[model samples]
Target: MDIPSGDTARKRISESTIHRLSRYFRTLSLLEKENFETVSSKELAKREKLTPAQVRKDLSFFGSFGTRGLGYPVAELKAKVSRILGIDRIWRVALVGVGNIGSAMVSYKEFIKQGFHIVKLFDNDQRKIGSNHKGIIVSDIKNLRTELQDDRIEMVIVAVPATVAQYIVDDIVKAEVKAILNFAPINLKVPSGVHVRNENMVMELEYLSFAMVNHHSPKGGGKA
Candidate 1:
C-alpha cells in the first residue's frame, strides 16, 4: 500500500495531525492484540483521550478507513498508518558520537522494531573509536563522511558536543545525507532541503514544568 506523493495532501498535513495518526496506529495495534476486528472513531478517541471529531478529521485527511457501520478494520488501518509514516520498510541509520545519549538511542528497542536500524557509529575520541556497542563498531570521526557515503546511510543521529557539532554536520551534509536527528543542545545551521530534528531534553522538561505549575494540559492531543 503505497501512499501518493500528492503536493496538496502533503501541504495540508499539520504536524499535529500526523502525530495523532501515530497515536491512532498504536491504539489500533493494541486493539488487534485484544482481538478487535474493527473500531469506531468514538472508541479510538476514548482510548487516546481525544475527541471523536478530531480522530475522524485526522483520518479523513488521508482517506476513508472505516465503513458506514462496521468501522475501521484494526489490522488493516495499522498497516496503512505505518506505510503513511514511512516506517513500513527498513531505514539504514548512522549514529555520530558514542556518548550517553547516543548509546541510549542505540540500545532503544523501539528504533529497530519501528524500522530504524543504526548500522554505523562515529566518534572523534580515539579511545571510543574501534570499540563495539551491541555489534556495531564505532568508526573514527575522520572517516565519517566516507563511511556514511559508502554504507549509503539514509539518516544520521548526532549526539556530539555543541562546539564541534556544526563541523560534524558539515561533513554529513557533504556526504549528501539530508535527515538528521540532533541531540546537541545548540541549534545547527543546515542548508535548505535538509531536515533537522532537535532533541532538547531541557526545553521539553521546562515545558512540562511550566504546565505543572500552571495546571495546564496540552490541547489537541499534543501531550507527550
Candidate 2:
C-alpha cells in the first residue's frame, strides 16, 4: 500500500484510527518499559488483539515507519504517535462545575501525564468558588469566559448539569475555546469550527449491557 505523507493524511484520518493510535502509543510505552528495542507489526497487533495488516494500515495513514527486518523503534514510534495525537505538548484546560465528576477529573493523574494541565477550575456554587484543589483556586462560573480567555485555556471540560451545559458552552465558544469535553447527558450545539466530545458514562454502560445480552463479539476477531 502507498503510505501517504504530509498534512493531507491528517485531513483523511478517522476517529477510530486516532483511537487506535492511542492504543499503539500505550503498547509502545509498555514495550519500552519492558526493554523492547523495536516492535514488528505482528507483535504490536498481537498485543493489541488486532491483525498485522490492520496495524500496518493504521500506521500507513501517517507515513512509513517500519523496516522489513528492523521493525519500528519503540521510543521513536511512541514519540511520533504522541505528536500525531497532539498530546506531545501541554494543553491548558479548565474544568467547569466542581461536583462529583468534575472533582474526579481534577484528581486524575493521567491528565497531567498526557500533557493536559488543569490550570483553572470553575463552579457556580459559592462554596466551591475560591476553594483550592491541587493548587488551583476555583473561579466562579460567572467569570468563566473572561477567566478562560485570560488564562488562555485551549480546552475545557464541562461537567455541569445538562440544563446549563448549553449556556456554559455558549460562553466557552465566545471565549474562542475550540475544544470541549462534556460530561452532561445532553448533546451540545456548537458552531462549525468548535470541537466537542461527550463523556456519557451511562451511555457506555448501556453499550456494555447491550453487548453482554447480545453476546456481541467486536467486529475484528483476528489476532495478528
Candidate 3:
C-alpha cells in the first residue's frame, strides 16, 4: 500500500528531526500562549540550541511551514505541528501493570490534559485487578483482549516488571495493539508494524549523574 504524504514525510525524516520538531512545537505553543505573533528561525534556534538552517530544513519537511521573511506564525505553526504529530487525534491507551508508576500515570493530569486517555488498566494481582484508582478500575490481564476489542485501544503502556515484560508485550500484541511505551528494562521484540518505545529510567539517571560529575570535575575532563 502507498503511504500518505504525511506518513512518507514522517518516515523519511530523521529521528533527530522529529525530536527537534517536537521541541519546536512545544516552544511555539508556549510562545503562542504568551501572545507572540512571529518568531525568526534564528531566535527559535537560539532558544532551542539548534541551528537556523536545521530548523528551517526540519520545518520544510512539511512543505514550507514558515514564510520567507516573516519566519513562522506562532498560532499557525502550532496548529500545523499539532496536526503533523497527530496530537489532534485522541489516542485511547491501555495501561498494563497498575503498580506504582502505572497508578501514578492513571492519576497524572498531564496525560488527561493531553489527548492520551488511559481507558483500561490491567494487572495480574488479584488484589489490584478489581481495585479502582483515579476513576480507572483495574482489570485482569486475561481480559486484555476483550477490553482492547471493545475499546479499540490503539496504544499500550507496559509498566510491568522486567521478568514479565516480554510476556505482557506478547499479550498486548495478541490484543492487536500497535504502539507501546515500555517502562521495563527489557528489550522487547515485536512483529512488523508494531512500535515500541523503551523508557530506561536507570540509564537516564546514570546519564544525568555522569553529566553532573563531568560538569563539576576539577580538571573538567571526566568525559564519560
Candidate 4:
C-alpha cells in the first residue's frame, strides 16, 4: 500500500485520524502479543471504544486493509500505520531544561522504542551541567546551538519554566529544529515552517475538572 501523497491529499487526512492510527497500532501490538492473527474492524473498534464505521473510515485514508470476509493481519497493520506516521525511521531529539518534566522525559524508555532518541540534554543550571541522568549527560544550554548543528537533531523538547520557554524555543528554531514539544505552561512564538505542540498538564486537569462538573450538572452535562 502507498502513503497518502501530495499536500492536498495530506491535508484531507486530519490529525485526529493520525492519532487514531497510533491507537490502532498499539491495539494491534497488544493483539499480536495475545497471539491473535487477524482482527475485524468491529472487534478492534470495540477494544478502542470506537465505532466500526469510524475505524474503517480512518483506515481508508491510508489504504484498504482486511479481506472482504476476513480481517486485518495484526503485524501487517502495525507496520503500515508505523510507516504512515513516519515513525519507521528513528528521529534524533534534543531536550532543553532538566526540570522534573524534562528529567522524566529523558528517562522514559518508550521514546527510544518508538524511534525517538534523545541524544543530548541541556540545562542552564550550573549544578545540573555535567550531571548524568538516565545515561545522558546534561550539558549547559549555552552549547545548544553548537550541539544541534553538530548532531542531526530534528525535534526539540522544551520543558523549562514559562518565563524562559520562548527564549529556549528561539534557540531551537535558530538551530533549525522543525518540530518542538513544549511542556511549559505558556505559548511560544515560532517562525513559519516550524511546528510546536504544547503539553500542558494543568490545562488538561482544568478541562477534566470542567468535564466532571458538567457530568454532574442539572442539564445532564450541558455547557456551563
Top candidate on TM-score is 2
When 1 and 3 are scored with TM-score, the better candidate is 1
- Itemize residue pairs with steric clashes in candidate 4: none
TM-score for each prediction?
0.92, 0.93, 0.89, 0.90
Residue-by-residue lDDT tens digits, candidate 1, 1-224: 34457664244688889888888888888999999999998899899888889988898877898898788899999999998888889999999999999999999998998889999999988999989899999999999999999999999999998999999999999999999999999989999989999999899889889988988867754464
lDDT of each: 0.90, 0.91, 0.84, 0.87
Worst 10 residues of 1 by lDDT: 1-10
Q: Rank the candidates by lDDT, best first.
A: 2, 1, 4, 3
lDDT of 3 by residue, 1-224 (tens): 33467545243767778788778888997898888998889989888877798889888877777778788889998889889888877999989998888888888887766688888999999999789887778899988888887889999999989999998888788888899999999889999999999888799779778878878553323321
Mind giving the per-residue lDDT tens digits that candidate 4 earns over 46-142? 9877789988999987789778788898889889889998999999998999998998899898999899999989999999999998888998899
- C-alpha RMSD of each candidate structure in angstroms: 3.0, 3.1, 3.8, 3.9
Full candidate order by TM-score, most accurate first = 2, 1, 4, 3
Candidate 3 residues lying further than 4 Å off, grouped into runs, are 1-11, 212-224
Predicted structure 3: clash tally: 0
